[model samples]
Target: MPDSLDPSLPRIFLSAGELACPERPSIITTVLGSCVSLCLWDRVRCAGGMNHYALPYPFTADEEPNARYGAWAIEGLYECLLEQGSRPAHLEAKLFGGAALIPAPQAQLDIGGRNVALGLSELRRLGVPLKARRTGGQHGLLLHFRTDTAEVLLRRAGG
Candidate 1:
């Protein structure tokens, strides 16, 4: 599919019971693994959006939804920001995801680390400043945000 044909450019959708905002100031929430969820907020405009992506790029024919990839998911978030009238130079970000959810001692690959690093790098490339972040752990997260108030609620699984 062409870049413009990507599914992330449209309005919000529900996947795995999570909300993904692809336009305007919309509240979205979800859980993730090595995958990352990025929250983009335009404080001056009092608007924000979020995206939950399984992989950095489109999954291969044999792969399942790997929400941990930064490539595909980040692109979706960017498209949403643009659609919301966010000026690339005027945007700010809050990042989450990349949990080392596997039990320690058996934890090997640092998927969370990669996700966080890529997320930060992408934000910088887009000229958005990363204002806050919570990443790397052995637990899942339930995220909530209200675009009107620019408030984010983070609930850890079973907590």
Candidate 2:
């Protein structure tokens, strides 16, 4: 893939609690606040995927593991790429989101901080090297991820 994004490439909007691993070239875009998005790709296979997770983990024991949580989202995206013929050793990651957009007292709750921490830890646990990141601020973000090329374009939203 080239540095330029081809206009014909399909575009998909990723929402919180969702993940996408396309078999073909595509552009995945999403907006984020406290939510986090992890973009993973296999350098050798040219395959990639992305996940948007709202929380670091389930708050209760009865909660079923799902993509809405960081742990599950990370693992699910990894598995999806692997199933798409990506090898673990070739995986690289880019972390995004985790902005402290809430006001005052509520901002102190630090869901963004927790999200960033969990994302970093999970990537390490998976043995994926983080190639880049745009995290931690008082504003939201918009991301444009190219699946086949593993290129990301980030814009600070209302910063």
Candidate 3:
């Protein structure tokens, strides 16, 4: 229920612009820096889903949001979970990643910050309650989400 990682569990790694809600229990995992990932758990179904996004907002707001941007990522992930039998009212969230990894100008860090901010705002707008978080630092993170129990183990990884 906390920070345990079982070696025997099946694991799935999500690349940027991807979202997943496995039919079976899995150790859904991903690595991130300057990007953001949302760990969404459905209480009624006892299932969970995850998403990884590079930017908080899309290039064009009206181009139909998908998993590539945070706005669409949140939308797509929720839609996927709903299609898989989860109720919007029974959902809770855990947020991860959004690190200032690159050594570019302030623009790079600003992007990371924007990712976190937008994620929080979007979830709020959609009425999803955020339960936990391990985001916004100068290093990357490795996330292991236990789909069966809807628990997560987050390790501060690279910088």
Candidate 4:
């Protein structure tokens, strides 16, 4: 059996503040509620990555460079994969997150909804195919990406 963390087939764990990939097929995982995560894959090359971002920004502008946001998160993930030799044309996306956990009366603001919209728009601007998505609900999600097969598994909290 191969080691789970094998570089050629690594098991990457992406938290709210991280992203990762592998030279070969790998597994990338993250947790989210209102925040959104976009998983990018190059079907031809079998190379891809994933990102988890909180809001669109920590602040409107003048925010710290490391601030976690959809724009920066998507750019970073795209660059990382490209640097690894994945082409943009071959890129496909799987988007997840944006949950309205609070009751409707209190969940009016809907930052989660905003996150989902921003994520989709960003991906579209980059010309990536929006293959599938699971957004807008009252529950959190646990996502797992299988880079080898380009498979995504989403498990809803308490369901």
Candidate 5:
């Protein structure tokens, strides 16, 4: 529904390992391929945020946790929305990405599946109701999220 984002609003491209939660309205976009993005919005406060992560978990115990991992990204996005005056109970979530773009053998780990699983579990843990989702397939996706309305427009990447 975000036709072109108000030309005046800031438009941001969310790269993997990045998160954005602005106090004002903006348009946030990202591309996904086996990566996952957790989009959050608080209806009561009219605040929204998004995060992109490439891996399901941190690689090491000593690794500085950040938005690059599912756990950290979810937590960060939630906290960011909270800081914007949104109540925890009012948060609604939308999940996307985690496509198995490349073929994987039966025994091989499905990174896309794991990423989706982690995102769902984390949202449940935070008590955020999942309102929408478009995930899991062989093709990549391009996502555009409107922070003011929490509306998302998705298209298959390269389609």
Candidate 6:
């Protein structure tokens, strides 16, 4: 909550299959490789959220849609903003992750590409303009998002 890097400011660490949108000035951070982390911010409300998903699309109807899937995760974040009285048109977006963690044939099962594309498509369909992004390559990422200021700090793993 404080401008300084106060030890008291809550730091939420998103695991491989987690997502959240908080009202307080909490810092959300996560790591990704081939997976995607989509961050959405509402400038008017000074609020933001992020989701970490492993896959771009849901495979079956029988499966319960989860935050681990981009289809659900992306919309879920949008819904949170709307619920907070933030208009869809007023929201800005930033996408991260979708790295080529594996060194195999980059096309056959390029899940990373799918993840980035899916995020971009959904944001476009929602009419939310994507302002920035860091995606693709053969490395994992360390992302820090400040919810209060909607500031993001990113770095490639082991860089």
Regions of candidate 5 where Cα sits further than 4 Å from its true position: 1-4
**Which lDDT tens digits does candidate 6 get at residues 1-159?**
345435566898998668889988778989989999998999998889899999987788888879888989999989987898889878999999999887767585999999999999999899999999999988999988888777888888888
In order of TM-score, best first, we have 5, 2, 6, 3, 4, 1
RMSD vs true structure, all candidates = 8.6, 2.2, 2.5, 3.5, 1.4, 2.1
Q: Per-prediction TM-score, please?
A: 0.72, 0.93, 0.88, 0.87, 0.95, 0.93
Cα lDDT of model 1 by residue, 13-112, tens digit: 4353132553444445566665677887777667677766554444475654334356656766667667767677767888887787775554335666
**Model 6: colliding residue pairs:** none
- In the range 1-159, model 5's lDDT, one tens digit per residue, is 446566678888999999999888998999999999999998987779899999989878999988889989999999888877889999999999999987888624788889999999999899999999988999999998889888888999998
How many times do residue backbones clash in model 5?
A: 0
Candidate 6 achieves a global lDDT of 0.87
| Per-residue accuracy of model 3 over 72-154 as CA lDDT, tens digit each | 89889888889999999989999888887766586645777889998999899889999998888789998888877877877
By TM-score, who's the top model here? 5
Please give, for residues 58-129, the per-residue lDDT of candidate 4 as tens digits.
Answer: 665777654268878888888889999888999999999999877566544788888898888888799999
| Alpha-carbon runs more than 4 Å astray in model 4 | 1-9, 104-108
Candidate 4 vs candidate 5, TM-score winner: 5
Candidate 1 lDDT score relative to the true structure: 0.65
